[model samples]
Target: MSARKVGMMTEDELIHVIRAAVREEFSAAGMRVDAPADVDEARRDFMFLRRLRGWVDGTASKIGGAIILAVVSGIVWLIVVGAQAFFNKP
Candidate 1:
């Protein structure tokens, strides 16, 4: 789905879409997806693998953000060091 379409959906609709997509993905992977009737029910369960895909997806975004920040910071540092060297030269 497009980001614009998802952005226009209500909270409940978005939840349903996301849940269905996750179920489809799990089914494709040959994993048994036993989704609860509602998200609250899923949260109540104590299964280790439940919501693992969501956890991994969130973690991957966080890692990507961190890498982007690090790369930008390095570029900024190089620019600053080069500026200082140019200013200090005879």
Candidate 2:
């Protein structure tokens, strides 16, 4: 069945149709449909959190690299200046 056709039905009508389907399925198998299966909402939430964590980790790593580069460049500049000062003739 198309989604549009299902959507056109009222909420009660939809529920009634679903119940009927379930009943028919259960009757065909000679089984009871009293208890439904449990859904894992936490799994979806955990995946969303994990993705955010990855993004934050990548951003932090990039920022840390930039900081290390800036510090190393400054140290190199200081060493070059000190060497030039101490080695040049008076």
Candidate 3:
């Protein structure tokens, strides 16, 4: 294997190399890798917002579903108990 000296690289070159390596790693993990020029500040901000919105939507739906289920079960139990009491009257 050939060896290169890290100290010989300029700061910018070292940074670029590290960035490329990290990008490759994420790409290998099946993520869509956008070119650096394609991802401006606006794109980054939108990505963050989109992810946050998705999280909030998923959590809210789960909570709402649980609340609906509890309310329905409570209503059913009350109806059943009221019917039994009325029928069992002496």
Cα error, candidate 2, residue 36 (Å)? 8.9
Write candidate 1's Cα lDDT for 17-83 as tens digits. 8888998886686654574444444455535455776799999999999999999999999999999
Which residue ranges in model 2 land beyond 4 Å of their true spot? 1-41
Check candidate 3 and list the clashing pairs: none
In the range 1-90, model 3's lDDT, one tens digit per residue, is 359554688889989988888777767865545766544754786799999999999999999999999999999999999999999999
In model 3, which regions exceed 4 Å deviation? 1-41
| Residue-level lDDT tens digits of model 2 in 31-79 | 5555443114435656889999999999999999999999999999999
- Runs of candidate 1 with Cα error greater than 4 angstroms are 1-50
What lDDT score belongs to each candidate, Candidate 1 first?
Answer: 0.77, 0.79, 0.83
Q: Which lDDT value does model 2 have at 40?
A: 41
TM-score-wise, the better of 2 and 3 is 3
Among the numbered candidates, top lDDT falls to 3
